[model samples]
Target: MPELPEVETTKTSLLSLLEQTVLNVEVRQSSLRWPIPDDIQKLRGQKLRKLTRRSKYILAEFEHDSMLWHLGMSGSFRLCDHYTELRKHDHLIIQFEDIELRYHDPRRFGCILWLDQNSQSKLIDTLGPEPLSEAFNAEYLFQKFKKKNVAAKVAIMDNHIVVGVGNIYATESLFNLGIHPAQPASSLSFQQIEQLVVEVKRILKQAIDLGGSTLRDYSNAMGENGYFQQTLLAYGRAGEMCVNCETTLENLKLGQRASVFCPECQPLKKVKIAPQKAIKGSKA
Candidate 1:
C-alpha cells in the first residue's frame, strides 16, 4: 500500500491541477474500496484550488468542497493527454481543458469520496497526530506507549497512536534507532523514545525527499518510481549482512508484517521492574 511519503509525492505531482476547472469525469468502474460518489458530477464546474495530504489520504480542495483520495494497495494517478490510450485498470478519469487525470488500481482498494466544505470525516477525525508534526514528539509517544504492552513495531504502526508509520517505515525506523522490532513498547526509556522520534522523522523525510520507496507499484503522478528503495538498510535485507556491524540481518513476522533487523545492532533488552511491596494496612 502507498504510505505517507508516496501519498505526499503524489499530491505534490498534481499541483498542476491547481485553479483548473473540471470539464468532465468518467468512472469506468465505480466500485472501489467504496463506491465512487454517484453525485460526483457536481464537481464538473468546480475549480481545484489546492491539494493537501493527511496521513495517506490526498485532499483535492475545490471552491465549495473537497475530494478525498486514497492510493490503495496498487493504486496510482497519472497525467495524460486527452487522446491518451486507457489501460485495463484505468478506473477513473477527470478531464480538464488541457490535460486529463487518470486513476489506475489493480486491487480496487483505493477510494475517492466527496466531503462537504464544512463537514468532517470520522475517518480523518479519528487519525492520530501526523508523525512529522510537532504534536508527535518523544513526550507524546512515551505517554501513548506507557499504556500499551504490544511490540514497539506494532505500537508505532498504530494509526490511532501515530499516523503514516507503515510496516516498511516502522521496521526501518526501529532498526535505525537500534531498537528491536519485537521489543515491548513500554520497555522504552525516555532516551530511547527520543531517539525513536528523531529516527522516524529522519527516515520519513528522507523517504519523501527520495520520492518514497518503490518496492512495488508505487509511483508519483508522472509514473516515476521512487529511489528510496535503493538506499534501504533494513526492511527486506533479511539474511543479508548488516551495513553497520556486518552481522547477518534476520527477518520475522511482527503483527503479521515482515520485520528485519540486525541482531547485534538491535539486541532485545527487557526492562526490569521492581516488585510491588505489600501495603502496611492491606492484606498481602
Candidate 2:
C-alpha cells in the first residue's frame, strides 16, 4: 500500500500535468479489487481544478467538488502522453487535451467514492493529522498515546492516532529513535514520545524524498519510483544484522504485521541503568 508520501508524490505529479484541465474520464474496468461507484461516468468532461490529499487519498476535485476518488492499496497514478502505450492493469484512464492520467492497480484495492466535500463528510473528516503538518508533532502523538496500552509501533500506525503512518514507517520510525517495538504506547515518557515524533517526521521526509519505500507496487508520478528500497535498514530484513549494531535483527508480529527490531540497540529498559567505570578504582 502506498503511504502519504507516495500519495502526495502522485498528487504533485498529477497536479502538474492535469490541473485545471477538463477530463474525459473513463473506467476501463469498473469492478476493481474494491467497489467502483456506479456514477463513475459522470466525470466525463469535468474540469479538475484541485489535486488534493485527504489522508492517503488522492482527490481530483471537479468543478462541483461533489465527486471525489480514493486510490486504495496497490493503486498508482501515471501521467502519460495520449500516445503512451497502455498496459493490461490500467483500470482507469483519464484523458486530457495534452496528456493522460492512468490508474493502474495489480491488487485492485483502490476505490472511487462520491461525496459532498462541504465539510469533508465521512471520507476525509475521519482521518487524523498529517505527519508533516504543524498540527502533528511529538506532543500530539504523545498525547494520543497516553490513553492507550497498545504497542508504540502499532499506535503510530493507527490512522486514528495520526493518518499515513503505515506499518513500514512505524517500524522505521521506532528503529531510528532507538525505541524497542514492544514498548507500550501508554508507558512512554514525554521525552521518548517526543523523540518518536521527531524521528517519524525525519524518517518519513527522508523516505518521501527517496520516492517512498518500494517493498511492493509503489511509484511516484512521471514513473519515477521509490529509492528507499536501496536504503532500508530493518524493513523486510528479518534475520539481517542491525546496521547500527552487529546484533542480528529480531522479527515478531505486532498487530498481525511483521515487526523487526534490534535487541541490543533498542532494548526494553524496565529500569534505568548507568554503567560503572568497568570495576576500576578511579577513572582511568
Candidate 3:
C-alpha cells in the first residue's frame, strides 16, 4: 500500500497537471475499492487548479469540482504519451493535449471519485492532524494516550491519534527510540512521547526526501522507484544483525502487523505507579 511518503511523492510528481485543461477522462475500469463515479466525466474540459495530499489520499482540485484519489494496496500513477499502449491494469486515464495520466492497480483496490469543490468526505474530515503539522505535537499525543492500554506501536498507528503513521513508519519510529512495540500506551513517560513525536516527524521528512520507500508495487507518479528502503535500519531486518549493537533483530506480530526490533535494544518495560494515598484533611 502507498503510505504517506509515497503518496506525497506522487502528489509532487503530479503537480505538472496543475492549470492544464483536461481534454478527456476515461474510465477503463469503474470498479475499484470504490466505484469510479460516473460524474468523473464532468472533469472533461475543466482545468486542474491544484493538487494536495491528506494522509494517503490525493486531492485533485479542478476548476469546479475535485477528485479524491486513493492509491490502494497495489496502485500507481504514471505519465505517458497520448499514443502509448495502455497496460492491462490501467483502470483510469485523464488525457491532456501533450500527455496522459494513468492510474494502474493490479489489485483494483484504488479509488477515483468526483466531489463538489466545497464538499467534504467523512474520510477526510475524520483524519487527525498531518504528522508533519504542528498540531500533532507531543502534548497532543500524550493526551490521546492517557488511560489507553493498547500497545504503544498500535496506538501510534491509529489514524485518529495521528494520520499517516502506517505500519512501516510506525515500526521504524519505535525502533529508533528503542521503545518496545508491545509496551502499554499509557505507560510511556512524557519524555518518551516527546521523543516519539520528534522521531516520527524526522523519519517522515527523511523518507519523503529520499522519494519514499519502493516496497512491492509502490512507485512515484513518474514510475520511478524510491531509494528510502536503503536506509532502513529495523523494518524488514528480522533475524539480521542489528546495525547498532550487532544483536540479531527479532520479529513479532502486533496488531496483526509484523514488527521488527532488537530484543536487547527495545525491551518491554512497563512502569508501575503506586496508588496515591488520600490526605487526612482531604475529603474521602
lDDT of each: 0.91, 0.78, 0.90
Mind giving the per-residue lDDT tens digits that candidate 2 earns over 38-98? 6766776677767778788776677654445556777887888888889888888877778
What's the true lDDT of residue 33 in model 1?
A: 95
Clashing pairs in 3: none
Maximum-lDDT candidate:
1
User: Could you tell me which 10 consecutive residues in candidate 2 have the lowest summed lDDT?
Assistant: 271-280
CA RMSD of each candidate after superposition: 2.9, 9.3, 3.8
Per-residue lDDT tens digits of candidate 3, residues 135-235? Answer: 99989999999877899999999998899998889999999899999999999989999999999999999999999998786888788999888989999
In model 1, state the lDDT of residue 235.
86
TM-score of every candidate relative to the true structure: 0.93, 0.88, 0.93
Model 1 TM-score is 0.93
Please give the RMSD of candidate 3 to the true structure: 3.8
**Candidate 3 weakest ten by summed lDDT:** 113-122
**Clashes (N, CA, C under 3 Å) per candidate:** 0, 1, 0
